[model samples]
Target: MFKHLKSDLPASVVVFFIALPLCLGIALASGAPLFSGLIAGIVGGIVVGALSGSHIGVSGPAAGLAAIVLVAIGTLGSWENFLLAVVLGGVIQLVFGFLKAGIIGYYFPSSVIKGMLTGIGIIIILKQIPHFFGYDADPEGDFAFFQVDGENTFSEILQTFNNISPGATLIALIGLGILILWSSVLSKKGKFFQLVQGPLVAVVIGIIFYNLTKGSDLWGISTDHLVSVPVPEDASSFLAQFSFPNFGAIGNPQIWVTAFTIALVASLETLLCVEATDKLDPHKRVTPTNRELLAQGTGNIISGLIGGLPITQVIVRSSANIQSGGRTKLSAIIHGFFLLISVILIPRLLNMIPLSVLAAVLFIVGYKLAKPALFKTMYDLGWKQFVPFIVTVLGIIFTDLLVGIALGLLVGIVVILIKSYQNSHFLHIEDKSNGKHKIKMTLAEEVTFFNKGAILKELDSLPRDTYLELDVRKTRYLDNDIIEILDDFAFKAQERNIDIHLISERGMVENPPSFIEFFKLRPKSA
Candidate 1:
């Protein structure tokens, strides 16, 4: 992992700059103390990163769970009770890992996964637009269509148009301009430019811009428009920020229910991110899904023991790590350390950086994930693939991440069943011999109950006095329902004066007594 220190260090810096605001923002969105988000970020980075099999996946408090966390906190009656539920949730996830439930991730179609990445990309772009224009009414990490600020995604964008701050807009444009130049031109010029990423430069300039214009009424950026990290007055106050879970809540049935909810949702989100991150990996390394669940479970437990929110593998940071040239888990670990250190040592300095600069960085990340070329590429793949992909994208834009994926998966299953119904077998007509019609029917590789209708229809439509050649040379597994259909067809064939030839790996049989007996006599096909 250390072999790529030069690359990992710079990537970690980029992740750190991105994660800081997100940690605070997600905590704010969850209705939890801001410091709790940082705690989860630290634990997710160092603890989960160390245990995870993934090379580029980064874990943290997720925006997807903000609504759940907010409601659970109120429903459970106290923040301490909610923390207890988080710890219990982690235990449940560990159980799920031990039970080998990670295979659930493999069932998702590739079309849906690609759609998820694209949908998230569009969401990031939409959510950050207001921030890009100096509108700070909503938290930076809120990804839901309906926000906690009493406005939906589109309403917030419209609100930004009416409330743009001149200073924030000016610096945001400068930050975006610097990012484009550095990524497209300067980074290609030399190794030094590559070592120092564009986001770092943009953030530094944003801080300088904030300090330089502190006194100018028209150009000065307000506190509301900047990154907000809780500044501790002293060591005691900082330590006081950490809250312990109430063990007494363990007896409440509601706590158990909340625990199961978090476990299921967090595990699913982590599994999805693991799959998506593996696809984005340049080296194409596959992560062990069960091991990822174990790591996430452990992270959530530690986070809950402290005052942090629930933890999961997050796509935003994971994709940022991949795009910024992260080569190993060290980048994630180091980013966690950065979160731990900055909040302790230089939080006041961190609070000075403008939110618009981070928004500019996110704009680039969003563009990379949802490039215009991807839409045409999905469309070219045909309706079977494109329908699910397009549906997932629309669902995510109008609803939430999980709901969108669910909608896509449902559509994909319907497409599969339709294809199966039409592709059960192939029919070929042979030239007439002695005034008798001859037809050959070849079975598909695997004939299941789904293909029963197509196979039965073909048999029922056959004419009398015909010679039928039933070939099963390539069939591996034949369903019992199909065999019963063939048995009924055999009786009908005899009454209609049709002669049947059954072809198989074990050789041919002429007019077998029973279709079931014939298959039982032959060995199973490979």
Candidate 2:
């Protein structure tokens, strides 16, 4: 894992810069203590990162769960009570992992997964536009179109027009320009530029800009537009940041219900992200899904114990790691340390970096995710693939991440059912010189319950006294439903005077047994 530290270190720095605002923003959205998000980020990076099987996936607090967290905290009546639920949720996720529920991730079609990534990309662009232009109307990292703060995403952009801070706008534009230059040209110039990324340089420039424009005219930006990490005046106050879960709340039924809810949602979100991250991995490494669930569960447990928000594998952070050249889990571990050190020793220094600079970095990240070329590619794949992908993209953009995926999955399932209905089996008829219709029915490689209707229709349509050949020579898996259909047809074949020829790897059988009995006795077709 440490074999690629040279690449991982710099990538970790980039992910660290990306994660900071998101950690704070998600916490702010969750209605939990600001420090809780940081705690989750720390645990997600250090603890989960160590346990995860995915080399590039980064875990943290997700905006997708903010509404749930907000409601759970309010319903539980105290933040401590919610923390109790979080711990319980971790236990449930652990159970899910052990049960191998991670297989659910594989059920989603590729179209939906691609749609999710593209949708998130579009969201990042739309959501960050205001931030990039110096409008901090919504808290950082709140990408949902409809926010808990009673504001919509596009409206905030309209609002930005009325509240533009010239300092932030100038810094953001400069930051984006620096990022483009570094990534497109400067980074190729030397190893030094490659080692020290554009984001680090952009951050430095932001801090310098913050200080230089301290007393400027209209160009001056306010403290509200800055990245805010909680600062402690003394060491004791710094140590006092951690909070413990109220274990007594475990007795409440509501706590358990909330716990189960978090587990279900967090697990699903984590699984979806794992699939998406694996797709993004340039090396095409497959992450062990069950192990990833276990890792996330363990991280959430650690996070809740220390008063942090529940954790999941976040795609935004994971994609940032991949795009920034992360090669191992070390980058995630290092980023956690960065969060720890920044909050502990240099929080005030962290606060000096403007939100716009972070927005600029995310803008680039978002652009990579939802490149215009991807839209064209998806569209070119035809309606069968394109519809679900587009719907998932739209759903994610209009709703939250989970809802969008669900929508996409729904469409994908419908497409599958349609295809199944149309592709169960193939039939051909030839006129024989002996004055008979030579009918042959060929089964699909795998004929499931969904194919039962189609198979039955072909069997019933055979003319009386026809020479019928039922071929299972190429089938590998025949569902019980299809077997039952064959058995019933076989039982009534004598009444129709239709001679049936059953052929398989076992050769021709003059008298076919019951479909179930025949299948049990003979080897399946290859």
Candidate 3:
């Protein structure tokens, strides 16, 4: 992990910059204390990062869980009680890891995973645009289309037009230009530019811009548009930010329910992110999913014990890390340490950085993930892949992450069923032999109940006085539903004067009494 220190360090810094505001924003969105979000981010980075087997995946307090955390806080009665639920959720995730439930991540289709990455990329761009122009109504991490501010995604963009801040807009544009120049030109010039990173430069310039324009009413970037890390005055005040879970809430059945809810949702989110992150990794390293669950479970347990929100593998930060040239888990761990140190020592300086500048950083990340070239590439892959890919992209833009994935997965499954239906069997016809229609039906290997309709349809459509050849040489597993159809079809063949010849690897039968009986009497032909 430490072998790529030079690359990892710069990538870590970029991830830290990206993660800081998100931690605070997610916490604020979750209706939890601002510091708690930082706690989750710290734990997610340091603890989970150290323990996880993923090289590029980064874990943190996820925006996806904000709504759940918010509702659970209210439903469970108190902040401390919610913390207990988070702890219990971590325990549940540990159990899931031991049970090897992480294998579930492998079941998701590649098209769906690519779709997820692209969808998130598009969301990041759309959501960040308002912030890019200095409209700060929505928190940084709120990726859902409908926001806590009572505005939807598109509506928020319209709102941005009326509330743009001149100074913020200027710095944001300048920051974006710096990023583009560094990424496309300057970074290619030498090793120094690579190590310094475009984002770090943009952030520093943004801070300078913010401070310089502070007194100007016409161009000033206000505190509202800046990073809002909780300002702790002294040692005692800083320590006081940590909130312990209420053990007294253990007896509450609602607490247990909330814990399970957090566990299930967090696990699903982590697994999905793990899948997506691996896809983004240039090295194409496969993360051990079960180990990831265990790491996240441990991180959540630590986070909840000390007044933090639930943690999960977050795609945005992970993508940022990957895009910034992160090569190992060292980068993720270092970013967590930066979050911890910055919040403690340089938070005031950190707060000087404008949200619009961060938005500029994210725009680059978003563009990398959802390049227009990818659309045409997916389209060329055919409708089976493209439909799910596009559906997922649109679903995420219009709804949320999990909902979009569910929709894409549903479409993927439907596409699979359709393909299965079409490929169930191959039917060939010979030029009417002796004035009687002759057809040969070749059943696919592993024909199941899904193929019942297609097989039945072809059999029913056969003309009277037809000569039929039923071939099963390649079939290995035929469903009983299909066997029953064939049995009935054999009876109909007699009424229609359709002579049947059954050909199999075993031998040929003029007419099988029952496909079920015939299969039972003979070995399953290979």
Candidate 4:
């Protein structure tokens, strides 16, 4: 893992910058204390990172679970009760790992996965718009269509336009401009710019701008426009900020439900992240999914115990790690360490960085995920792929991530079934030989109940006095429903003077009494 330290160190720094605001934002959305988010981020990075087999996948507090956490906390009555469930959830995830449930990740279609990434990318861009414009009523980067505050995403943007803070807006624009220049122009100009990431540069400039405007009320910039990192004046004060779990609420049934909710949601999110990270890995390395589940479970268990929100492998952070040229697990591990050190050692400095600057950084990240070219590429793949892709995208945009994926998977399965029905049976006509018509009916690889309708339709369409040959040489499975259809067809064939030839792996028979009995019949004395 440490083989590529030169490349990994720089990438780690990039991922760290990208992860900082996200940790805070997700915590804010989850309705957990702000530091709780940082705790999850730290555990996801340091603990999960060390245990994970994935080289590039990064772990952190996920925005996807914010709504679930919010509801769970309310239902459970106290944050401590919620933490108990989180710990239990982690244990459940570990059991999933041991059970080898990680194989589920491999079953998801690639087209659907791509659509998911694209959909998330679009959501990130949309969610960050208000934050980029200096709107703070909502969390900095909440992506759900409906927010916890009861405002729809679109409505929030409209509201932002009316309640715009001029100072915050101006600084955000300047920060965004600098970020764009750094990424597009400056980074390309020399190695220096590349070594120093654009987001880092934007953050530094934002702090400097905030300081310059602090003394002068003439700039119209208020303290709210600046970063709101909680700064504790002393060690005792900082220690006071940490919240302990309420173990007394363990008997509540709602607590168990919340734990199950976190376990399921966090596990799914982690699986998706593992899949996405594998796709992004330049070397195309496959991460051990079961191990990843266990690692994430451990991270969540630790995070929850510490009063942090549940942890999962987060795609945004993982993608940033990959795009920034992270080559090893060290990048993820180091980022977590940075999270721990920064919050403890330099809380005052971190408090000075503006939210808008982070928004600009995420804007760039989102654009890369949902590039226009990706839509065009998917369309070119034809409707079989495009339909599911579009369905997934729209579902995610209009609803939430899981719902969109469920809808897309449903469509994809229908497509598969339709294709299966078409291929289940085939009729072949042979030239007349000795004044008799020869018709050959070949069954598909697997003729199940689902194929019964198609097979029955073809058999019913056969004309009278047609010499028929039933072939099942390659078939692996024959459902009882299909067996009945064939048995009935044999009786009708005899009445119509249709010659019946049954072919199987064993050999050929001129006449088979019944489909079920045909398998029961032994080869005629070799």
Question: Could you say which candidate leads in TM-score?
Answer: 3
Compute the lDDT of residue 55 as modeled in candidate 3.
95
- Please provide TM-scores, in order, for all candidate models, with all chains considered together: 0.96, 0.91, 0.98, 0.93
Model 3: per-residue lDDT, tens digit, 1-526? 6799999999999999999999999998999999999999999999999999999989999998999998999998899999999999999999999999999999889889999999999899999988898889888878899999889999999999999899999999999999999999999999999999999999999999999888999889989999998889998999999999999879999999999999999999999999999888888889999999999999999999999999999999999999999999999999999999999999999999999999999999898989999999999999999999999999988999989999999999999999999999999999899879989999999899999888988999999989899999899988889999999988888899999999988899987778778877766554
Question: What C-alpha lDDT do the candidate models reach, one value each?
Answer: 0.93, 0.90, 0.93, 0.83
Question: Can you list the residue pairs that collide in candidate 1?
Answer: none
Q: How many clashes (backbone N, Cα, C below 3 Å) per candidate?
A: 0, 0, 0, 1
Candidate 2 stretches with Cα past 4 Å from truth are 432-435, 459-467, 483-500, 504-526
Instruction: Give per-residue CA lDDT, model 1, range 4-71, as digits (tens).
Output: 99999999999999899899999999999999999999999999999999999999999989999999
**TM-score, predicted candidate 2 vs. hidden true structure:** 0.91
- Candidate 2 residue pairs that clash: none
**Model 3, poorest ten-residue lDDT window?**
517-526
Alpha-carbon RMSD to native, per candidate: 1.8, 2.7, 1.1, 2.7
Candidate 1, superposed: residue stretches over 4 Å from native: 494-497, 523-526
